[model samples]
Target: MATKEFDELALDGTNYPIRASNIKINFASRGILNTIEEPNDGDPEIEPRKLNTALFLLRLYIHKDLKHEYMLETSPLNLWKALKERYDQQKELIWPEANYEWVHLRLQDFKTMAEYNHAVHNICSKLKFCEQEPTEAKKIEKTLSTMLPEDRILTQQYRTNNFQKHSLLIHTLTQAERHHELSLKNAQQRPPGSAPLPEVHFNVQNNAKNKKGFKGNSSNNPKNLTGKRKRNNNRRKFKDRKKGKGKDKAPQPRSNGNKHCNMCGSDTHVAKDCRIPKHLVLLYQKSLKDKKSSENPRFEAHFNLTHEERLEVASSHQAPVELESNINVLPEDVAPLSAMDDMFIEYCSTDPLGDLQ
Candidate 1:
């Protein structure tokens, strides 16, 4: 199992060397295999009934971390071989098939660590391996067999047997392996006190000591309890009072005549009259007075204009004409000849030339 031999084996494309140095070795002179205490989970370190419980946990761990099925279509022998090859350097060796079979049968229907441990206890009873002496294997078997297969074996009460060993070991191992290394790199790395590792940090501020975030403020002070209750009662009372007042003030039926016009359509002038200009109103009044006066007999003289007078008035507005120089009339001839000549001309015009003589 030299490193060179392992390298050669790697060159040959075999996953594992024939004699890997890391494989578990039996240091005990008697050649009997050793059993290291299974890493104590914080649960009460109940004595294991069968070794397979540890193997189950280990297998589960490997499967989850490796993200692959441990023994898909693979025989139990192959699993044992692989386990021995990889982790044989560890203190506990996975037992041969006969012991494995005995352990596996007990664990087939195990639901919790307690049930599994009890099964281990049953096997230990038959095998007589544990320090706490086995008394009643038959009784345990009878009870377990008769119990419904679907029965939940774990309870909240037994959730953590709170093994001191597990707690201390986890703290030591995690700190030594992880936190310590991190602390060396980061000066502020403080190992978690003793709180259980949370799946998620739900409490943004971890004030578990004061219950600051875990419970509301009202829960802490008992004196404020009655006051809060009173406030809530007052709120309800106010709402009830409002509802009662609303009922009292319920709407009454409306009357028709009492309603007022929306516009200036009452005894007062309408919107058109209200908006009419003052000057326009004055003009309308004057026009009405004129119309009334025109219908009266007293205004007749004022109304009539005689024909000549009307003509004189009409001619006064006509465009003036200029007379030519040869058409000038003599004053005496034009003046006296006007009336008489008109008469003589009217008389003689009836007789032709004889009337003229």
Candidate 2:
């Protein structure tokens, strides 16, 4: 099976520490770290199985060329020791880089405080791996020294307040940066200036100017021109100008007074040009005919016709009720109304109103 969790460890003298660490972690996980850490002191017969397992893991992660050469080794412990001896020398080669990076680590070189903090931690880790870990004081001093020139005063302020704690210094820097970004954003959104007046204010001022001094026509009483009249006026004015009637002059009226149409009574057009609705003209002609033939009119309107129709409709669906006489008829056995009057006069003459006897 494939145990290649990482890139194959090249035979070249590069990137051996990280690869070896990964290999160790992989062996520890498989319960076979002991094969490399200690010898197989339990059983002689089981020794060959463990040796093959360890060799398989190592070969799975090593270069193809190194695989064939390392197969000749019979012991896992000696092979582990030999691999370390050949690859572990790169640490010395990495020391100069750690020192150079440490000297050049500048907070100003990174855009954010978080990025600078990350760089500091990363460089410190690299140094610690190479046995050159930085102290707390050295890290703070490095940060203070590498700040941008504009922030030199800010560094002094932090130090004056005894912000020797690296965490406190970082917190202060981050807060100050946040406040600075907010201020810049606010400044860009709206600058320091008086606000301009609204649209209605300008319109009112222009209207006031025109009302106070404009003399040819009052602003209140503008010439009411219909759309068609305005178009005709413009067409006639253009023709007149082409004929050299006048230049830069107001258009002349078509007549001494506006042409009044008798059909519709609109002053913009004469009777010939009037466009009265046909329904309205027809009704008018009907009114004249009705007046001329009032006694024998063509359209004879019956008054209260809807009431008569309603009574007819109500009786149409109902059966007729027969009656020989109405309730006003008196029966033969009843006395006449003259006898009723005599009885009433006799009852009245008896003096029922005399003292309550």
Candidate 3:
């Protein structure tokens, strides 16, 4: 860490083979490598300071327990030799395990090319420290041989590239794996008819429940009466406008003592609750006409009939035309008024569906 060189490794005996190799690199950077390899006495002036710096680093990083044994050694060359002799046997001790790892290394065993690359490099590094480093071609062959059965064609292609270095082979594998993954993802994206939408589990916010309680949906809402009852309800609403609100509430007072008479002229007192029809209210009718009310207007209609037209109108209706009960029908040989007959004829003509039938 102190110098911009190969990092110092702890002098742990178990990993002494790699550790010693790293130490050599560390010493070489300090210009004190000759002190270790040539075993010469460093110059009393320049070499002593460089040797001392190297020796101090070596002493500082060694196993703390082993410090006492090498503390008395003054010369760096003797000290360096002493460390090698003590830990050099580590290479022989580690040789079999490193050989086995290199021999058994396989690309297929690793889930990713990165992991396979790391494994190959790790084993190669250890083998190199043990002085049995694998050749570039041998490492390349190892990868090809260990590939999955499905990747035989891919392995052959890599072999055909004549990769001169192990690193080039590793880069090729990584790039190939990337393209292969892209192909798989592309294949998965192909639509059969249309790509299925991701399943969503959600509720419509309008009718959804809150934290307080569950909400009422359309099905849970109050139901109105159906069929004939529904028709009766609509009729009742229209009728309510013509009449009063309900039988429960009282109507406007007609008492002479209370207010002026605006409808029918009557001397006898009428209960306040009694309803007065709008048709009897001349004042209201006058005001409504003055306002020219478009929403509600009464028009007197006309009626006329030809014999052929009468026959055709009669044929259009599915139900038997109830002549006597109809508003156009008159008793005692009296002719129906023009306005009444026209209303009945117009009602039939307006019903387009009934005309087709």
Index of the highest-TM-score prediction: 3
TM-scores of the candidates are: 0.14, 0.47, 0.49
For model 3, what is the alpha-carbon lDDT of residue 274? Answer: 32
lDDT, candidate 3, 193-259, per-residue tens: 6776754545445335553384565445445334557789889988987786556565664546554
Regarding TM-score, does 2 or 3 come out ahead? 3
TM-score of 2: 0.47
Pairs of colliding residues, candidate 2: none
The CA-based lDDT of model 1 is what? 0.42
What 10-residue stretch in candidate 1 is worst by lDDT? 2-11
In model 3, which regions exceed 4 Å deviation? 1-12, 39-46, 187-357
Candidate 3 accuracy as TM-score: 0.49
Encode model 2's per-residue lDDT on 1-357: one tens digit a residue.
Answer: 674678878889476767778878988897777777754567434367767888777777888787777878767777778788887777787778878999988888999999988887777766776889888778778888889899889889776876656777888889999999999987776666756447868988988988786556433444534655788999998997788744576756465366876665457778898688978867766876788887654432433222222354332223334565767888899988878764645244332335323
Per-residue alpha-carbon lDDT of model 1 for 34-78, expressed as tens digits?
A: 223334457453344333433333343232433254646133234
Q: Supply every candidate's count of residue pairs whose N, Cα or C atoms clash at under 3 angstroms.
A: 9, 0, 3
Mark the regions of model 1 whose C-alpha exceeds 4 Å error after superposition: 1-108, 129-357
Error of 3 at 175 (Å): 0.7
Residue 101 error, candidate 2, Å? 1.5
